[model samples]
Target: MTAMIKAHEIQGVIALENSFNRVGLDHVVLVKVATAGVVTRLMGGSREEVINALSNAWIDGQSLRTYRHAPNTGSRKSWAAGDATSRGVRLALIALKGEMGYPSALTARTWGFYDVLFRGNEFKFQRPYGSYVMENILFKISFPAEFHAQTAVECALQLHPRVKDRLEQIEKIEITTQESAIRIIDKKGPLYNPADRDHCIQYMTAIGLIFGELTAAHYEDSVAADPRIDVLRDKMTCIENPQYSRDYLDPSKRSISNAIQIFFKDGTSTERVEVEYPIGHRRRRKEGIPLLVKKFETNLARRFPAKQQKAVLDVFLDNRKLVGIPVNEFVDMFVI
Candidate 1:
């Protein structure tokens, strides 16, 4: 668990900057790099072997951001991280088997990753690897929407009761959000699939306002076929709040803030609803953990028998007991 946490820290810290995204590369490349480094170390690889595995990861081709953006968004964005992590493990094992690696895979002048993919700019870091990322990780406790749109969904849900019965009376909806949300999820036009819908702030907020809930199923075609969703979506105008954007990148705050207001055709408006820190934020950990545990139990109930659920929960719900169990033994608890 510590090793995995460290891996997450490595990836998350590097991802604090817009490094990979600025280069049009998907951040899952960090998953490959971080996983290779940590998993190689876990398998007892020597320093040289770890270095070789890391080099292999860097040399591995990265996925483009296209699959995560409009016009090409699809389920590939969902599985890209899994694919990258699998490749990471494969490279680590190969390196352990004595496969050679390029020493300059990232800096080999003309053909290196930096030159070829990053526009010749070196990767930047906000801080050294540590527990910061793990300590401050955000959970998607309430909605299956994109992280950038999490607070937006929350804001919409807050206003749901006021606007649910007056959908047609809404003349316009204004979404005030951070720059990151604007850059990534302020999508317009038709959303082709669940993947696209989940990434769109307007679509997510619409579902929250109309249904007073946002779930993974809300993004499906059946629910999306409702014309009111598009009606709300079309009425939405996303505007970036500079302060919100600044606070988002501020390490001290790291807020994902959003506000939503509805204007009625009769010239009246609902009070603007704003959410600064989402339920998943570290600041809201006290409120988030119980919900997270409930989500876990609900998911477990879907596949496991009562006895199996209890057995799994017995270990996971107790921190000391969970920590004492060997990784393989812990994994075996879930094996059928």
Candidate 2:
């Protein structure tokens, strides 16, 4: 535990993100699981948590949603972190109860988390649990954008002021992102929806640069159709993260840092800027948690009442109270 960065910590994140990227898992789901798992451990969990969580959790069985489609991503992200915490909790509980895990979990499914998500691989231990995950979770600080695209968004934000007067002067917008950007966000042609548009590195970077602001609405069809977006995506390029990948997977490090550069028709290009972790990461916890809480508050208020929201927030703020609260109660609060 001293040497290893808990899968949920920033260090763990660094390792998992790079390794999973090889197989196609985004840092988001892994981050969720890592946070939830490590947190669960903090709450004194065991293996039963993982199994029971796995049992109740559904695998969509749809090829479009399966790992084989991308060999890296899937829908499990929605609940996987919760699943992970539950798994951790279950494992802890199982150990407490003196029950045994199905030995097959380590080898059974055509491949476990390894074979299924990892390309017939095994977990390579670079270290053990520590404050690493919290220390390195990338912060979505500048833009509430995805981790991989945040730097690109930041670059666009900078260009927004300069390009505002030259929207027409820009013959083409050129930008570069890490290789993960190309695989996960780079796109061409008409982006039909916000989901599609936001994922397009070109669309995301261009809009941020042009508008100086990016929100969930920025990715919508109306915004995506703004002609300028496609013009920019047309100029975008993304490449693999050799060092980022190296540092990303090094058990002692975890980051979603990305570099972004822009060019104008006149041939002058802005300096490339790189950012490693999202503001929401643990390293920035001292500064970012309050902001994350704000985000959580904003999001919670959107779907829940003030009183209910208060209760939920209060519980989350209190570690002892939160861990003791029934899972059903937590589920009930989230359910409409």
Candidate 3:
């Protein structure tokens, strides 16, 4: 979903619409990891990839900086498939060895990836880390959605209980998202479709308010028309939480939390509520971790009400889980 939504966002960027490039470097981050994968994989298992990996990474990187916040549009954003292994293919074609066509194709755009994509200005990398290849920790955890708004959705889930009753009375919804998020995810205008709908923090939060939750189903065109959703989105106003912004960037303390509060027409308000890190974040490892066993258990339980969830769980728990397990045996577990 991140890829699909990101592609849409890329379309917006190409169209020269609102650029997330200025404040939030979300675009370059994804593009680099995507195009540079093969080169990075080849450089070393433990050691970082060679400097030449920069070539592709640079193109992907500078593109983010080139048009951020400048309204734009294009079809690139709609590509459902991710990168096409540009690094390996490029290497295979050139077979060049000594100096690179350039170092850091992504993060550096000038005499680099930029000359290829953005025209000229040097692309700026947000931070230095091996994490760029895999993507930031926060980006990895999001099954599908922007990293900045993860906590925003998390906050909405928690606030649903309190505000569901007073949803109609909500004169306004005030949100505190990372300042970067305010600059990036905030949007207005016709939502062309679900891909567009999911990225709109206002729309995502409103779904959490009216439905008291969001699931894949909530984004469908049929469901998006719910009267309360548009009402809440239009009534909403969001501001950046400076500290939240700081915490969000701390690599060791990464978070995607959002704080939400609802105001009533009569001038009353509910408790201000917040979610710091989403359940999916790395910090929640000890508590929110979902073991393979639990996934197997829950899945089996759903498929066979009369069958045993414990039996399914035990198989996953076995220490030698996959070793020596025949392909047929592995496939059998999934069948009812």
Find the candidate with the highest lDDT and give its number. 1
Order the candidates by TM-score, highest first: 1, 2, 3
lDDT per residue (tens digit) for residues 184-245 in model 3: 66977656566667667888888877776777688787898787788888888889888887
Q: What is the Å distance of residue 108 in model 3 from its true position?
A: 10
Which of 2 and 3 is ahead in TM-score?
2
Worst 10 contiguous positions by lDDT, candidate 2? 55-64
User: So what's the TM-score on candidate 1?
Assistant: 0.98
In model 2, the runs with Cα more than 4 Å from the true position are 1-120, 129-131, 138-144, 171-176, 239-241, 251-253, 307-336
Per-model TM-score on C-alpha atoms: 0.98, 0.66, 0.66
Candidate 3: where is the Cα deviation over 4 Å?
A: 1-20, 23-81, 84-111, 114-136, 139-144, 291-336
lDDT of 2 at 258: 68
lDDT of each: 0.91, 0.59, 0.58
Instruction: Return the clash pairs for model 1, or none.
Output: none
